[model samples]
Structures are given as C-alpha cells and as structure tokens.
Target: MRKRIVRYLLALLGIGAIGAAVFLFMFIRPLPVEVARPAEAVPVQVFGLGTVEAHILSKIGFEVGAALVELNADHGDRVSQGDVLARLHNGEQQARVARAKAGVVNGEAAVKMAQAAVGKARAVLAQKKLTNERKQALLSRQTVSVESAEESQMEVDVAAAELAVAASDVDVAKAALEDARAQYQLETVLLDHHVLKAPYNAIVVERHKELGSVLAPGEALFTLVAPETVWALAYVDEARAGDIRVGQPAEVRLRSLPRQMFEGHVTRIAIESDRVSEERRVYIACDHCPDRFHLGEQAEVFIRTAALDKALLVPETAVEGFDGTKGVVWTVEDGDLRRREVTFGNRTLDSRLEITGDLPDGAQVVTTLHPGLREGRAAKVTEEAAP
Candidate 1:
C-alpha cells in the first residue's frame, strides 16, 4: 500500500510541472507585432499669436477756445478736409465786427469832410496871395499909406497859417480812415474763427465735448484718426530681435480678429530693449488696411526670420521632453525598436517637426507608448492614420 501511495505522489508532481511549463510558454514572452513606418510629411515652419494693426494713430484737438454751440461729427463719423466739425457762439464776435464796420464808415465820412476843408483852405490861400500882391503894388505906387499895406500883408500871413492847419487836419483824418479799415479787417477774420473745420480726411474716434459745453483752447474736441496711416507696434523678445530687419515679410493677427490674417512688413525695430521688460519694440506696416480699425488694439506679429524647404520631418510627439530637450525617439529598424538622438529645428503648427540626423526620410518610428522600450528591443509602431 505504501509503495502505491509513493507512485501516485510521483505522478501528481509530473502533471504539475507540465502545467507550469505550458503557462510560462503561453504568457511569459512578448507577442509579435507589425512595425509602422514613419510618414512622409511636408515640413512647414509656422508661427502664431500674431495680430493686425493700423499704420498710424494720433489725437486731434482744437486750437481756439469757446463754447461748443454745434457738433457736426461724433465717434465713427467720416470727415473730409475742410469739413465743419464744430462751431462756437459768434454773437459777440459778430457785434464787434458790426461796430468795427460802423467805425470805418464814420472814419470815411470824416476823411471826406477833411478833404472839403482842404479845398476851402486852398481857395483861401489863393485869395490871400492875390491880396498880398495887391498890397505890395499899392505900397510901391504910393496909392495907399504904408501902414495900410503892411496890415494887408499881415492878414495874408494869417490866412496862410489857417490854410496850413486845415491841410494838417486832412492828413490826420486820412490816417484815421486807414486805421479804421485795418481794425475792420482784423475783426472780420476773428469773426470767421467761430467755425471749426477739419484739416484732413479722417475718422472721428472720440468726442470730448457735447453741445453747449464750454471748452478751453488746446482742449481736445474730437479725436480723429487716419486709418490709412495706422501701424502695428509689437513687442518682440530681445533674443529673437537680432534676426529681425526692416522690410522683412511678416504676418500679423489682431487679438480682436483672429480669423483674418494680414500681411505686413517690418518698418522699424527699436535699438534698445525695455530695461524692465527686456522686450524690443518692432513697428510693422500693414500691406492693406481695412476701411476702418480702432486705435491701440493689441496685436501679435510673426516675422519670418528664416525658411527651409524639402527638409526631413517627424511627428512632434516623437520628440521627447519639453521643446525636444534631451530629445529621444524610438525608430523601427528591421522590425526592432532602436533609440535615436535627434537635433530639432523650428516646429510647425501642425505638430510636425524639423529634425536633423542620420534618420532617413520615410523611416519607421515607434509612436505607441510601451513598457521597457529600449535599443534593440522588439516594438510594434502602430501607424497613426492621417486625416
């Protein structure tokens, strides 16, 4: 009986060993997989966060001071050169002009009167000369006493003095007329100042004063902006600014309008960066501006500093770590996984990468996440179907 029990225990041990061997064979080894090839991708260098902007902007102000009696413009109003924008109360100015005109008329009448007086003075002088001649003749002929002739000559002298005074009065009156005319012309000009007109074609962006509101000189009445003259001011990093130059092609996208892409060119670059922000100011001129754009709108600019074509590319996901630092990739060669060290260039917007190394174009790369993936290891690179 003891011998039979030993035989049964020996048979059970043999069966257990066979079952463990079968389990190891079925589950311990890795399953064979089909390796995927790297895709043929067109390399593209793209930039984002750009903006659209105006070429120029400015604030318009008034030169004269007065109450705003009328406003012909408001925000978003289009104006042309010499268009009346506003007006001031002109009652006082008009009254002063009327008074000045009346003074001119009075002066003109005074000049006429003085001219008549001068005519009378000339006649009196002629009569006195004739009388003086007669007096001299009488004295020479001894027809009258010498004292009587002397008295007649003295009367002639008095008449000549009176005529000289009248002539001087006429000259004074003429000068007064000229002064009055000048005053009238000056008043007329001031009276015209009541109306304010635009100096150029522009769009009003702001209205600082309302009707019946008093405004001081040099105060802003309405702010006008020339949409055609608008430009974009961008703040670029100081490190990347060295590659930027005037006249380089650039792309801009406004924060407010993201769907639209506006082309532009670099017009200027600041020589110095901000001391605190360490950002350089870049000015860009838009290729074409819309019919209107608001001033001071924030924008992002992309300056195409460099370009490359027909370069070998890979999926951005193949590059390891942030910004491809410590960059590593699992490339499939002969159906086996091999780690590759790659040097990356500018990244494209579509998650494609520009890579430089011995990696061949259209080479297979392992993109699926797997455990224990290393050099000379078996891996299945599942092809990510393209959209």
Candidate 2:
C-alpha cells in the first residue's frame, strides 16, 4: 500500500512539472511583428507652434494734445487711408485759426494800400521833377524873379524827399503784410493737428481712449492693423526647420477654430533665430482664413517640404542612441532579428524618422519594438501601413 501511494504522488509531480514547462515555452516564444517597409507617396512635414499676428501693425493717435471730441471709428471698423479717425476739442485752435485768417485779410488790405501809396509817391516824384525843370528853365530865361524860382526849386526838393519817405513807408507795410501771412499759415497748420487721420487702410483693433478723454501728444487712440498684413507667426524647432523654405505648402489649425483647416504657404523666415527659445521664426500666409481673425490666437502649422516616392520610416521612440544624425535600429534578415546603426533624415511631423541609408542588404528595418526581440531570434515580419 505504501509503494502504491508513493508511485501515485510521483506521477502527479511529473505531470505538474510537464505543464509548467509547456507554459514557459509558450511565454518565451518569438511572436510576429510589423516591420517598417517603404511606402509609396510619403509626405515629409515639419510642425510648429504659432500665433496669429500681423506683419504691419500700428498704434495711432493725435499729434497734438486735447480733449477727445469726436470718434468716427471703433473696434473692428475698417478705415481707409486719410480717413478721419478721431478729433480733439480744438475750439482754441480754431479761434487761433480764425484770428489768423482775419489777420491775413488785414494784411492783404495793407499790401494793396502800400501798392497804392507807391503809385501816389511815383506821381508826386514825377510832378516834382517837372516843377524843378520848369523853374530852372524860367531862371535861364530871366523871366521870373530870383526869389520865386529859388522858392519853387526848394518846394520841389521838399516834395522829392516826401516821395522818398512814402516809398520807404510802403516797403515797411509790405514786409509787415508778409509776416502776417506767414503767421496765418503757421496757425492753420497747428489747427489741422487736432484731427487724426488714418495712416493706411486698416481695421481698428482697439479703441484706447473714449470721447472726452484728454490725450497727450503722440498718445495712442486707435490700434490699427492692415488686413493684408495678416499672417501666422510659427516658431519651429531648429532641428526640424532645416528643410523649410519659402513658398512651401502648409496647413494651419487655429485653436479657436479647431475643426477647420486653412491652407497656406511659407511666406518668410526670420534671418535671426530666437536666442532664448532656440527656435526659428517662420511666417505663413493663410489663403482661406476667416474674415475675422483674433490676434495672438494659438495655432499649429504643418509644412510639407518634400514628397517622397517611396520612404522607409520608423518611429522616433524605436531608435536607440540617436545622436541626431545616426541611430541603432533592429533589422530582420533571413527570418532572424539583428541590430544595425543607420543614418536617418527628414523627421516627419508625426515623430517618425526616415531611414535614408546604412542597412544590410536584404534586411528590413523594424518599426515597432518588442520584449521578445533579440539577436538571432526568428521573426515573422508583417508590413505596416504608411502614416
């Protein structure tokens, strides 16, 4: 009976050991995996975070200080160049202009009077010359008394002096008139300063001051931005910004309008990079943006630099010891797993690196990592769809 019980226990232990071995064998077996394969028509894109901004923005105000009297434009109002945007309480300036105008009128009259005085002086001088000639002729003939001729000659001399003095007075009056006209022009220019005009065609972004607010010289009253100057300012990482160039096609996704995608192109690239952020500034012009745009709205941009006919791609996380230029990747050759250090290029917007070179002949690069992946292990490879 003891021998029979021991045999039964020993048989049960052997069966348990066999079951454990089978489970371990199944757990450790190499599983099938999807390897990266060259896909037809793969697009390389670079991503950037950006904001809606205008290339030409301005804050305009009055040139002279006064109380705000009239406001013709408000926020979101579109104005043309030379349009009157606002006005200051310029009653004093107007009065000065009016006084200057009256002074100008007076000056015109004074100038005419001076011209008339000159004419009168010329007539007097001519008459005096005739009288002096007649007196000298009488003296030569000895027909008139000596004292009478001398008195007539002295009177002619006195009239000539009076004419010269009148001419001098006319010159002084004309000079004063010119000064008055100059003063009038100065006053007129000062009065015009009370009115503010738009420097260019733009949409009013904000109204800084309300009516009745006293504004100082050069104080901002309206923040204006040209509609045509609107563009997206994207800050791209320097690592991914190398391929970006002007005129490349791009797509924009605004935070406020997440469901919509606006098409655009690379308009400009800043010559100097942002020192602190280590980013390159790239500007994009939206082709089909909405009529209304909020400045500083967050945005995401994807620029298509190149389109590849066939590209082998792998996720960035699958790479090991990637020093930006080259990295180690697992490759499958002859139904076995192997590791290779490969050179990469063109990082896609989806965080995938393109396998450009450095692969063994007949070896397929792995796109996904797995715990069972080991050197010399057999692999059943499956191709994944291009993303």
Candidate achieving the largest lDDT: 2
TM per candidate: 0.58, 0.77
Give every collision pair in model 2: none
Query: Per model, how many backbone clashes are there?
Result: 17, 0
Decoy 1 TM-score against native: 0.58
Q: What tens digits encode model 2's per-residue C-alpha lDDT throughout 1-387?
A: 999999999999999999888865644455577778777687989999999999999998888899998999999999999999888888898899889889888887877887787788778778877877887898889978888788888877787787787778778878888888899899888889998999999999999999899999999999999998889999999988999999999999999889988999999999999999999999999888787899999999999999988888889988999988899999888988899999998777788888889988888888888878788887877766456
Best by TM-score: 2
Alpha carbon lDDT at 218, candidate 1: 74
Candidate-wise lDDT, in order: 0.71, 0.88
Q: Please report how far candidate 2 places residue 307 from its true position, in Å.
A: 1.5
Output the lDDT of residue 39, model 1. Answer: 38
